[model samples]
Target: MSDERSLATDRRGAAAHPQLCAGRRARLAEAMARLGGGVAVLPTAPERQRNSDNDHPFRHCSHFHYLTGFDEPQAWLLLEADGRSTLLCREKNLEREIWDGHRVGPAAAPAALGVHEAHPVDALDKIATDKLANAPAVWFPFGVHEGLQARIDGWLATLRERERLGVQPPQAQRDLTPVLAEMRLLKDEHELGTMRRAARISAQAHARAMRFSAAHFRSTQGRGLPEYMIEAELLHEFRRHGAQSPAYGSIVAAGANACVLHYAAGDAELRPGELCLIDAGCELDGYASDITRTFPADGSFSAAQRELYDVVLAAQEAAIAATRPGARKQDAHWAAVRVLAQGMLDSGLLNRDKVGDVESVIDSGAYRAFYMHGTGHWLGRDVHDVGEYLSLDEAPVEQPDGMGGRVVKRPSRVLQPGMVVTIEPGLYVRPAEGVPERFWHIGIRIEDDAVITDNGCELISRDVPVAPREIEALMRG
Candidate 1:
């Protein structure tokens, strides 16, 4: 691992950077105060059962983890308007600790996580009820956690019972998601550092999978190279480079499987002339890095594959050029669409006689048959990270709906420094009437993580090759 010092320490045992979490909590507290003073409760994700007597791997909630750097299950955080924070976590049971693993019990949570106070998990109802009494509002993420609304209602109900004693329940309930979403839209220095490391690791994994596929194909004369085997290679590289886990399910699509979009790694064999698309990324220190690269099963691409790959690569390049400070978020998507719409006509995927010009193709949405999905999305703690796509402060305006109609909509957000996004453009061709025969069963996507800078966006996931020649040279090595 190059730049090992830049990587965040594994946070499995304890909060790796309590000060950063403390700062985030303070910001939330101030935001709540600005919103008329309230108490906010956020619960971490619960452990889920996979099968009889078996449990799935536990992943902490992104919002909760953002506020408190704690990764334990069955934990909750309370942030008050006065910059006070409380943590409710599992109690220390030596036997359970032996069965599970080390837990930062309530006794140590205050100091370990930089919270003002801590209590056992069982005391949530009592403590929350007390905190909510006479508060103007209670804030929580609506439509997020199941059973959370009922839990807050229970607290309010408890306070209602003592109405005669001058105890008052919260007068209103507010959604905390929008407030936090705005705060998390921009990456701070600490988050940017961690995300950069994750991008590096995921890029290395993609390169490793490429080399593994090419070597296996050459040695066995295009035999015994399954998609799952290549997926395993990616996983191996991610773990070896200190990633906690894959950001999402790995997509190792071979040949026609690539057209399925969300295809999981399966037993599909890597044929010599076919393309294999691997869309995988790693999650390090809670931040995600998503990268996708399509390469030939052998060391070289077929003529049809190379042509389509170049088209998709050119689309991604156009998208990348439009991802910079002051540019609207939709600018990149439209830029890519313009390039792809033209490619579709030039390649005979869409007949110019039928689709007319590129503008007509875009206006009629005729290009969606081959190129669908947006050019990119916000990338951070979650793969498709939480952040509003539309500009909230601006008034809605009527715009052309691409079908010779008008619709009212808010404009997409304007790109700004410290924001992170993914620039992914793809063309998936399935055999159909009027489509080029040579382009059948061919799919190509080029994705990279981009960090918005003062001048332009920086491509963080470019450690792997994107050009046809570079990819061929890399696989040959």
Candidate 2:
């Protein structure tokens, strides 16, 4: 994609880019002070495998960056409220630097990250044990850090052995995720700015896909294009417009393939009379924006295609209108479901024997045949984002066998200020053995990136057309 210079702000120094990095230090210190005493371990993300002799781009973990803005890998940021944050990183490695990139070496980390002390990464065990001597707790998120977990376990084993001599260890291990997640949920000024740029970059790519696809259709207008070609055009546009990379794989599903919710293979060929559904996003400075649109393959929608498209579009609008701070996210999902089911009933797709009432039919799982996926998901660092739906004291969700587990097909918890999420409601009718021929294959989805605010939520991706007339005009252009 294009370089991030346009969207990039003045990040030359910590003083200049103080909001996400510098400001986070203050908040984290505040949290540490409140907890009495603890040693917080924040590890940088690991290098991801691509293939032999190659690796994917390295991205710093958000939590690590939050406390200490150091982006270097293999670093451990240890925070002690009273003392300084100790940054542990690999020292200068001449051989690896030649293969990879420049190194910020251990010596410079203290000054760069505003830390009081710094050391080589190999010293993690000794330092952690020494700091935790008088601490009642050791804080870190538990699930994703295997190596760190093992290190802590090993250290704890040694301390427990020392207990024979009347030595005490850290009284408890605390989960720091709640504190971090709460802080992230409320986007500061810098985060909102980054999100706006991310949405703009992705919007340009979406518009490019529309303009280019229409042009391709107009010329041999019916020459036909493969689903994968459309997919490539979108990928190119995103990068060309300044996205670091796609937030997720684009779903360029054509005809029946659109019925598959997360379809990413993108191998179908577009027919003259069919629909192409694209669900894609772009990442800017680690922030993400998600957008999905469905349009005619031949530049004009068929009657059935338009019908299903309108139903999905209406559902999206309903969901968008219901979004506001403090409103439970389930409100929008249920509202969209009500509108969608009513449209289906009017289309003769639902009956008394099949679905009882149009208003309540969706929650009964009657809509799965046509709408398999949830209406939306939280969007940020990761596609699903890093946060919990339930409060800190609430019990984790549980399910019996044969039922979709905790993370599957559940409504989002609530809409809160500074939270960014995707609002996408869709409908699909694939031809089936017992179904009528008229409803052969139709799929449509309209997604928007939204930011929740105090007064109301902001629609970050309104640039793309969603209305019937507007979409037609966009295609004509």
Candidate 3:
């Protein structure tokens, strides 16, 4: 694997980069102000033991991290609509720190994290109850964390009990997710920069995997290459580029394995003539980038492979073109569907006489036999990032019946500036009656991370080759 560390230099230094939690907390507090001023408690993910003695790798909750960049477990953030913030976290214990790891602890959290006050985790109940008393509303993620609802219930009960002492309890309860989700949907400048670096690193990783597959195939004398080897190449490139980890499970599907969307079982052997579809990406500084590329294991695509690859590529291109401000998110998927449906018809994969035109095929969903999934999804802190696809208004979707058909409702979230999404269009062809035998067992998906702009969209992962000739040349070179 190459020692290229393109992303290493781009990473912001830890000391130079404060968590910026102060600004984020202020913004969230402003949003919470509309709720008539209350207390909000957000907790980070709890550490779980992987086994009897060992603990699993700890990751902060996305919502929690969005509010506070604090990464430690056993931590809760208390936000007040009046612009005060408190961090309830673990207290320092030298004995525990020696065996486990260092913690900022309650003592330095206020100064280090830019909060107004800090307390030990044990004081959360008392503090939350006191804060909730006489407040108009209490807000938290309603059903996300297990037992969290019960905890809030207990707090409310405590407040109710104190009502006889002239203390008023919170009158309303609200879920804070919608406000936070909307805030997170539009990427800020810092987030975009981080996501762009993530895309580049992930794109380079894909190229590295392709090169590794090519070399491994040649070295093995056309026998085969294990899927895990290609996956390893992706991992090597990711970590070498300073990524903490892959954004999600690396899908290194070889041959028929590619047909299974979300396939991560990397036990299959990639044959020389087979197409390897690798859907992988990495996370950098809490942002994520997802990219998928399919290429021939032996450095070049076969005739059938090239044909299917072109169709998916064209579909992805149409999806990318449709990704612009003011356009609905579904517009990209429909664009990709139209292109893929036409291509399938032209290639004799779908009979025109039965499936009719692209519109009819789409209405009947006959194309789903080969192309089953959506064109893309929102990509951000999480691979399937949070954001509302639908507005409060309901729009009528005319069904094929022309009279009474199901309303065509999908995530109608309009494309907006700073919104990033994946434009991935794929065809997973399995052997079936009326399906072409040559196209059987062929799964081709072309994916690229796209950021919606005022004029159109920008392809962040454009560094990776998408064209057949370009991929072949890169492998041969």
Candidate 4:
């Protein structure tokens, strides 16, 4: 596999655009060194069949790709405590290449991927068994792959059988998810660059959808496009800007359909006075950007729509303002909840008699009637990235039976620079008793990707307009 085409060599003997991948591996190795010495194995995602002969699009496992920049399926990475990295993958085969595509197989993987060693993927079980014997600890995310777990179990059993020969299995088994997740939680400069690009492309896609809705609402022949057409416009913009795919399912909700949180766009017809809510984003270079925008299909908002839309927008603004370094993770959420609760009271969506003041409404859980979902989540390689929110504060204050307890002091994590989070505040009102008829069937959500900075936060999706006037003007144009 050591073809001239495989090596990304330059005049100075440095690989081109290698910082993002190579630097990440170096950092992970450093982190591994900090932990007790051992060998950790990570495998890429496996391909799944879509039908009898076809396969779904392959996506590399986020953790595996973070450690080793190999994107191909059926590949495994090994991290030794001595800062050595090895890759085990399918060997290059010209016959397979003729039918499928090119493969930078094991022969050239070391030079191509900057790994210390490379071997055929078929040898993984044997190699792994040898590496696992007499180890202080074996770090791997358990339950991810049953096959890998079985292999580990086999190695341990074999080592146990070799007790007469003085061979010993690993002393302890540690879960690697927490360690890798903590590393991934903080974005480096390279990850941030990719995320910014993803956000920009996603924002452009939303703008395209808005304009497409306005132009296709009513044609000269009096024919209108369905909700799926607007969804197509979003896909077009995303691909045009080089996005690999949408971060998640594109929600193109029209009319009452907007009230559905994860509405899937279909043949639903777009009406003139109905509000369209699109929650779509693009994934670029493995990073994900999430955004949502709500606007009228006819290029102008109705009075009732504007009233509800403004509330959601204000809530999102309050949430974004509270997303800064040193602020608790729940601070932004609570800020958004307070604003939305107040908006609900003002709009008569929540009755003062039963809901009482905003504080009482929040405490009594009355606000769940309208705002049910969380304001936002951690955003990164995966749409909903992994990172624990709770910090070790104190033990829970339980009842005398020690059941149905409440935490006396539960501390949330403080925001830090390089953390990217979403600020999505929404109001989904269904037809119910005590709800105003004017605001019924109205669902408005305003979301933006915010990157925490030293002073405040930066909204990467700011290019897409969220204000009513700006959305209308963009649609009109």
Q: Each candidate's lDDT (Cα)?
A: 0.91, 0.74, 0.86, 0.82
**Model 1 ranges with Cα > 4 A deviation:** 1-14, 402-405
The prediction achieving the highest TM-score against the true structure is 1
The digit string of per-residue lDDT tens for model 3 on 1-477 reads 232555688576222244565777788888889657788888988898999999988878888877767788999988989989888989999999998799999888877777889999999999999888888888898889998989999999998998889998889998988888888899877888889999999999999988888888778798778888888888998898899899999999999999999899467899988999999999987788999999999998989999989999899888888899989888898899889989999988999998799878877887888888888898899999998877546665543331214466543778899999999999999888998899999999988999888899989997889999999998987
Per-residue alpha-carbon lDDT of candidate 4 for residues 336-444, written as tens digits (9 for 90 to 100) = 9899889889989998887699878777768888888888899999999988775645444321111213345556678899999999989998999878898888889
Between candidates 3 and 4, the one scoring higher on TM-score is 3
TM-score of 3: 0.95
Q: Extract clashing residue pairs from model 2.
A: 1-239, 2-239, 217-221
| lDDT sort, best first | 1, 3, 4, 2
Model 3 misplaced stretches (Cα beyond 4 Å): 1-5, 13-19, 393-405, 408-411
What is the C-alpha local distance difference test score of candidate 4?
Answer: 0.82
Question: Candidate 1 clashing pairs?
Answer: none
Q: Where is the poorest 10-residue window by lDDT in model 2?
A: 399-408
lDDT of 1 at 35: 82
Location of the lowest summed lDDT over 10 successive residues in candidate 1: 5-14
The TM-score obtained by model 1 is 0.97
Error of 2 at 265 (Å): 4.0
lDDT (C-alpha) at residue 123 in model 3: 97
TM-scores for every predicted model = 0.97, 0.88, 0.95, 0.92
Writing each residue's lDDT as its tens digit, candidate 2 over 403-475 gives 2222423434667888887889888887765445666777788899888888878998877777877777887
